[model samples]
Target: MSKKDTTYILNEIRNYLDKFNNASDEYYSFIKLSNELSELRTTIQRIELADASIPYINQLKKQYDAKEQAYIALYKYIKHGLISSWYETNKIIKDIGKISDADLSNKNKQMQYLNHYKTLLQENNNIIKPTLKERIAYSLSNLIRKR
Candidate 1:
């Protein structure tokens, strides 16, 4: 994923956690983190192929998967009232699981994108070395021209 996107996701996750209450924080935090991770997964899928760093991408994917599993377990525990509300927590867990699973498939797409970006980079090294500012300018010019 792009650094900006990653940072955005991390910020969102942090924001969600910051608002968590110890009384119900675990459940709420898990749900928020899961949702952010799912969104990151989607964003990652879109740019994985464009990134030059495979190891980094893989690392992020692994981290996201771990977090997802953690959230799932937290949800289960909350659902059972092992730590919190049973019925309410169970309902939230079920909802999060359904949406999270559907969105989880994007991780595979991110792997594909990563591979594609690697290949493109290798094949066109001469054209991909512009500084970030230059790239942004070029993209903006193109956008403006299109408009």
Candidate 2:
């Protein structure tokens, strides 16, 4: 994928993060975030398929997986009525916005930023716990599945 495409995806991620901050509807915020993440994932997949020889693709994939996991946790929280603060994510978005095309062109620098961003998201995930509603929902789902 071109740097322009990556930059656009990053911008979309930033926009969604900003929306998540002030949005009254948690479900809408979660859906927007999910779509942005999907776009990012698709972009990464295209890059990997285009050039499997790219040494940094694995690192990028790892970062993407971490982000997906973290976001899944965030979604769970959102579904349970526990709205997460986007302060840390917004900071990461600002850092991403500062990344120049030169930085994006460099595999090591890109990996470094991606790894750091993934870590920040993971930290936020660790801080969030599923609300009682989520636990109850899970239990109900399990019971229904056993039938």
Candidate 3:
């Protein structure tokens, strides 16, 4: 990688980290929102077959989907940056392309885990409902433990 590319990749990594933190917050909020939506949907389904409240539920679902897409994109960008940086630092002059090809295979596996989590969330939305406050506390605890 050129020096400029490397710098750009580093900045991208930082941006990804920041976005990841924000996504974590959004994920928690989405969980709460999903729970509320689930309850509302259930109530609406019970009370009336067709109602205006359905749109609210649909809107929340769309917001959750958008947030999920953003999270996936940021995760891919960060993982790509990491692997590309690693390959650039370690590969032989003539083997850089091969290195990237191999690394991308591994990246695909990493993404599989991410996709699995996404699928799990979609399948059992209530299985992972960490409140925003709980997420913040968990993050702070993890940061402190790292130190």
Candidate 4:
């Protein structure tokens, strides 16, 4: 798993906590699921329209399944009122961090692919439109290089 992917999730959860603190009805998990569902819906539609390969469709389906499970779990947790303050939010963040950390460690057990992916992203950004994506790519690359 990429740092960006996990960091995006963490930032999203933080946003939801902010919303909840402001008396919003939306929970972080719910918003996360909604965003995932929206993304998956678009991908699924595009794949179907293009008559994508079976293996790719199967892969998307597996991802959809995983997101569905996460949504359900989050729904139940929120339903039980697990979130109340920063204390509760930190616990939830730690749970997600643990899973993502484990995934990253296991991925690195084969070989650290972080630099390779970052390089590819930079190359793509160099060739593509210099929009927000490119700006983020540039910023993240700089941050990574600094470390």
Each model's TM-score, in the order given? 0.37, 0.36, 0.28, 0.38
Could you tell me which 10 consecutive residues in candidate 2 have the lowest summed lDDT? Answer: 79-88
The positional error of residue 35 in candidate 2, measured at the CA in angstroms, is: 2.4
Model 1: how large is the Cα RMSD against the reference? 27.3
Candidate achieving higher lDDT, 2 or 4: 2
Question: What tens-digit string does per-residue lDDT give for candidate 1 at 88-140?
Answer: 23333333333333343456654344334334434544432445565566567
Predicted candidate 3 versus true structure: per-residue lDDT over 1-147, tens digit per residue: 344543454454455446557656755765665576566556555545565576775765676566567656655544444333333333322222222433434445443333333343344434434456655665576589799
Global CA lDDT computed for model 2: 0.62
Candidate 2, residues 88-126, lDDT tens digits: the string is 454555556566655555666544555456556656654
Cα lDDT of candidate 4 equals 0.58
Candidates 1 and 3 compared: the better one by lDDT is 1
Better model by lDDT, 1 or 4?
A: 4
Single out the weakest 10-residue window by summed lDDT for candidate 4: 109-118
Looking at model 1, residue 33 earns an lDDT score of 85
**Stronger candidate by TM-score (2 vs 3):** 2
Ranking of all predicted structures according to lDDT, beginning with the best and ending with the worst:
2, 4, 1, 3
Name the lDDT value of residue 107 in candidate 2: 66
lDDT of 1 at 11: 50
RMSD vs true structure, all candidates: 27.3, 21.7, 16.9, 19.5
Q: What tens digits encode model 4's per-residue C-alpha lDDT throughout 58-125?
A: 89988998898888887754543422333344444444544443564555532134333333434543
RMSD (Cα, Å) of candidate 4? 19.5
Q: Each model's C-alpha lDDT?
A: 0.53, 0.62, 0.48, 0.58
C-alpha lDDT of residue 59 in model 4: 92
